[model samples]
Target chain A: MSNLMTNYYEAAAVILFGIGFMNLLLAKNLIKKFIGLNIMDTAVYLFLAAKGYITARAAPIIAQGTAARVEDYINPVPSGLVLTGIVVSVSVTAFSLALVQRLYKHYGSLDLDEIMKKAKKEEKV
Target chain B: MTAVNYIQNIPFFSIFLAIFGGIVTPVLGNGKTAQKVNLVIVTVIGILSAVLLVHLWQREESFTFMMGRFPAPWGNELRAGPLEALLALCFCLVMALTLTGGSRFLQKDVLPGKQNLYFTMIYLLLGSMLTLIYTNDIFTAYVFLEINTIAFCAIIMAKGSGESIVATLHYLVICLLGSGLFLIGISLLYSITGHLLMENIQQAILDLVQTGEYAFVFAVVIGMIIIGISVKSAVFPFHFMLVSAHSVATPASSGILSGLVLKSFIFLNIKMFYCVFTIDLIRSLKITNVLFVFGLMGMVVGSISALKERRIKHMLAYSSAAQIGYIYMGLGLGNHEGMVAACFHILAHAITKAMLCICAGGLIEASEGNVGINSLRGAGHRNLVAGIGFTVGGLSMIGIPLTAGFISKLYFATATIYSPQKMVITLLTLAISMILNAMYFIPSAIAIWSPVDKKAKIPKPSRAMQYAIGIFIVLNVVLGIYYAPIIDMIEIGIQLLES
Candidate 1:
């Protein structure tokens, strides 16, 4: 129980991840699906951020006029990784949105099932 | 500088050259010009990596080059061993051939204005695959996985049809889910091991294993990584996206996606098994057992699905899933020979499937865009080269003697001899899959060759395409015949990988 409490952030993040994954899977609207994807990405970011943070530790920036020590700061790797993740997620979301926009333009529907029906009809013709 | 010093730069050069080609491609403005540039770039990389393979084989050693001045486990790194170089060489070779072979379709299928952009994506795709092959950092692999996914999605939709567009959207969604899983897995791993470099992580994992702590977390991490990659690679149950995306795309896109892209992820898994967790650890955890079950299911189920597909391209796509199953089956055997078999199958399947896609494109062209198997009757008579190519490719797929596929199957069978526990299941699946392979491939092969009632389009595949298909056929036969040296090379490569 103490271990679970101590890692509550990770627990919350995992739950968020599961919810986002479910939404991504079950949502009919393409935009909503992408929103779910974004949520999932955010959960990942949270998990990574929590992993990188250490209680009472300073940020990774080197202090001026003081000798640098490993103990002075939290691990900066995950922070850099989080930045990379944000960039990746932004691009992915933008790309997915652009695709969804094109899909909407083509079929005039945001629902996947409707678009698929229209596409099948189009193919039959 | 000495030859060794110069050889060390080949991996770096070969990767960035493709990216450089991609960057400069849009300036060319003409799709034709961009394509010519792309071919030149792939060819150059092919030659460079081929040379690197020879150099590495002779040296019998692997080298890691640090990006900029940063050291290991921190800065980015690229490692080249015999295996990496060999796979890179083959990828470059296959990409060049695929582009050349499918250039006509590219010209016809893609929008005129987007042709240069199409070539740019191809260049980037090549760069990303090479990066995936050579990267020593796990995060670098994940980043390139996204790049690869995006580039592939763009190419799939390059055909500019509603079907292709819709297919691309689905593909993008599924691929994002995959990469999202992969990213979280990497974060979890980094949190535990505090190292992103594969070698350092392996050491940390070794210590963790020895201490017998956090075993549950460890299993979750491996499971996440494996499932993420399996999803992307279209293993069995996750193969729904492959059929649509691969079938709807242009022949070039189909060939590259089905042939090379899937194989790269599998290669990454192999690397993780060998370099990240080590084989003994993986086996001890019984992860291979789970993979083994999935492998058998994919083999049997994928082949059965292929048998039921009506469209020629869809059938080929399903067969690819089955072949992926074969590779995974070999991996799941959990022996050194099985790994080698998996690698050989990778090579064999890359060549054979790419040829099959290009040949199918040619047949479709000759038949005036009808992809139905029945409609393809006498497609052989119209485009004889494509007909012969498809026959040979199909034959290879069925494990006919004197083809690359036969050698791989033989290797897999021999590999099963080492693991008696898996022997019965492995052999039974192999036998069943082989028959299943023949059941679909034979009919399709015969259908393309059979007589048709109507007149067929006499579209001759272009000179470049003819040359590309010719080289693919020749390479297939060569590998089938002269496999000893290649297998020896792969063995040496695997040794280098482990060391």
Candidate 2:
């Protein structure tokens, strides 16, 4: 039964990776690509969390008036790292979105091809 | 956790001050006030870094600081051995030079209202890079990497041009993907090891290898990590993003990105390969051969691209890519001599590339952005100081004798000789590339110095710009002549890595 859960989580992570990779390859809009990247990041976090889970383990938290028991609790380290990873991913996504907004303002278009053409014309002029 | 010991560790304090100064620059400066505050903050941070370096030099042993007093296995730590100290010192010194050299280009190119934003981003970039080299936690390194990427995007936006904005967006996408890969790799390792501490992870991997249960997984994770780092460092195929990004960003931003930001990733690569992964693991996986091949490809492709570039900045950007390939080749050799050569080249390239980028900026400003090679005609007959600086920097790039570049290249070449396959290919390729470098650089050099248009008036740089360029030139020549001290310092650093 534990192996089943692990397999399910692994499949989910792979699906997420696929979606992210596809979006990255196919999406031309910068914002959409970033969304794809976030999805991919979530996939990795899930993989890590799954890797740390064990059979018959409780959440990595101490009960009221009780000391922690390592044998009965899930590993908490990956979760902590995932928290940091989420923060970094969100920061990068926010900054990229901000940059996209700036690019739209400057070029008056969200299309990558249009922007490149416009820049080329400016270079010639 | 132990009580905070902030007063005892000067290097940590200095780094914090530099980062805080960066965060506060936007709040403290506006309009003319911004320039004054930027000058003061940068100067103070520069001096603080210098003092920290001097203190570090006087110490006889390596130092380690645990963040929040977490034990080695559970908490993140910062280690400042000789190598880390030397790299920190290099960053500080380059920051000082770039900040000073940047003023002229910033005043001319940056949108007036965004001056504070520009300086703030520069500070953030420096802070994150310094933090990256100092941190012992893989997760913390990832955080700093993200910070550097975001700050870099903001700096690109400061150019306030359509191309700059588009290029920045592309850079953002690639960096996000790269960081994602890095996180995946780190998470995989953390899950397997149950520890986030770098030293713990190293031991955990070794234990697993001993058990022989997860050797393939370990190799895969290591490959993912290297791939992620290569993307960040803009190696080979991952380099497409950098050319547009660096060439289109403001000249000052380009200087910082090429001179220091990429070098930070290279530093992390060295730490991960040499310190985190043992020699047995590296050899068993045959990773060195893969890296050597990719490095060779980057050197050739980068040179070819650079040779074809018509714009001055584009050429310099491509050249930066090629030079990075050289550093990787040195590291890929994976011997004592190779490691030493890589360390030396890092310093040499930082100084030389910064100088070239600054000179390019000055030339662009003087010509009102007519920076094509053909347009540089008769520039030398005009501004002798800037022209001479550009020539000296160009010669260094070509690995001419009596320059810093030549010293590093010689070491790398000698080290490659230990492996016959590498030596033959590297020597011949580098020889051919040097010729290619001259093919592109010589024309520009001649055009700049030639008296094609004698009557044209040459614009002299301000006192500040002159001082900045003068400092770089003197250091380049001085460092080239007295390279023994630097090599000895790097040897000490390599020893620390081995320990």
Candidate 3:
């Protein structure tokens, strides 16, 4: 219980992940599902960023004229990873939106179930 | 250039060439030109990988190439052992052959303006697959996983139909979910171990295990990684999306997706099992039990689903799911020979399924775009080469006496001898799945060859396509006959992997 309080950020990230995951799974609207995906990605970023941060340490950048020690700063790798994750998430979101646009034009609906039914009807025809 | 000094650079060179080929393809402006370039790039990579494999075999060693100046822990690195080289070689060969054999359909199915982009996606897909096989950094693997996912969706969407687009959407969504889970898993791993390199992580994990600390977190991380990969590769239950996507994609796209992409993910899974978390640890964690149950279910349920499917491509897609079940079952057996069986099955399925998908495409073309099994009457008569190809692939899938599938099954059976607890279940599932495979495959094989009331006039596949299919048939027979050498190589590869 003390550990949970100490690592509150990670716990919050986990809760956010669960919420985003459930929304992505249960949402009927395609765009809403995509929004859920974005939220999930955000939760991951939050988790990663929180892991990279240390309470007492400074940012990875060293100040001018300062003799720097490795322990004086937070871990830089996870921060770099967060940046990469964001780039990936952004491109994926763009691609998903483009696909949604096409789907909407074709099916006249953003609802996944409706689109699926219409596709089935078209296949039958 | 001097002697064998440059052999170590082959992995790097092949990855660069594949990706660079994709980048330069659009500038070629002509689809045919881009295709020629892509084929050339793939063949070059194939030759280079083959050379590297031979070099590694002769020296009996593996080598790591640093991406920049930094050493292992701090730098991006690629490692090529016998197993990685073999996988790279086979992937290159499969990609080249898929393109060659399915080019006719590619040209017909994809738009004139979009053909070049399609090849670009293929090149990118090949590059990412090779990276996934060779990468020493788990994070590098994750990055390439995204590339692979996007490229697969692109190729599937290249079919440019309402149905194909819908299929792509579903595939993309599921793949994103898989990668999202995988990313979070990686983040947790990094947070715990503070290293992204596989060897370093393994070292940290070993120490942590000795101390008996963070066991729950460790188990959750491993579970997330396995489940993430399984979902992406469409192991049963999560396999519903695969049927629609593979069936709706073009022939080459389906072949690549089913044959190479899924196998690469499985290979990555194998790597994680061996390199990151030792098999003993995984067994102790009881993750193998979960995999075992899923594998059993997938074998029976996937085959049953395939039997129920009426469309030829849909059946083949379902069969792919069943074959995946076989690989997972082998992995779940949690023995040395079980891993060997799994690797061999990967090769068998990659070669056989690619040939099957391409042949199905040829038959569809010969039947004037009809996809139903009933409508394929006399398709064999119309396209004799495709008919023969499909027959051979089907027989291979059914574990017929002298096919690649038979060798894989033999290995699985031999592997089961080591695990007494799993023996009965493994053998029973094998038998049941084999029967189920034959029940659907044999009839479809005969139906295609069966006579029709009115003969349909259709164009034959191009010479390149026929030649590609012919080569696959020969490779299948050869693999079946020469199983001893390949099995030995796999054993050596596994030893190198664990070391």
User: lDDT tens digits, residues B1-499, model 2?
Assistant: 3322432365566568767877777786564566667666656655655555555555535566877866888877877666776777777777677767777677767888788877778778877887887787888888888999898888877877877777787777777677777877887777678777677778888888888977787888888887788788988877877888888876667877888888999999888886677655775787777777777788888889988988888899888888888888887776778878988988888988888888887776666568788887776655565677789888888888888988988898889877676788888877887887788888889878776644655467767667777888888887788998778777876777656
- Report chain B TM per candidate: 0.98, 0.95, 0.99
Compute the lDDT of residue B406 as modeled in candidate 1: 100
TM-score to true structure, per model = 0.98, 0.94, 0.99
Q: In candidate 1, what are the lDDT values of residues B126-191, reduced to their tens digit?
A: 899999999999999999999999999999999888888899988888888788788889889998
Model 2 DockQ class: medium
User: Which structure is stronger by TM-score: 2 or 3?
Assistant: 3
Per-residue lDDT tens digits for candidate 3, residues B326-396, read 99999999999999999999999999999999999999898899999988988988888999999999999
Query: What DockQ does each listed candidate score?
Result: 0.76, 0.68, 0.76
DockQ, candidate 3, comes to 0.76
lDDT of 2 by residue, A58-99 (tens): 988887999877798987877777787788777777777777
What is the C-alpha local distance difference test score of candidate 3?
0.90
Summarize candidate 3's per-residue lDDT along A66-90 as a digit string, tens digits: 9989989998888898898888888
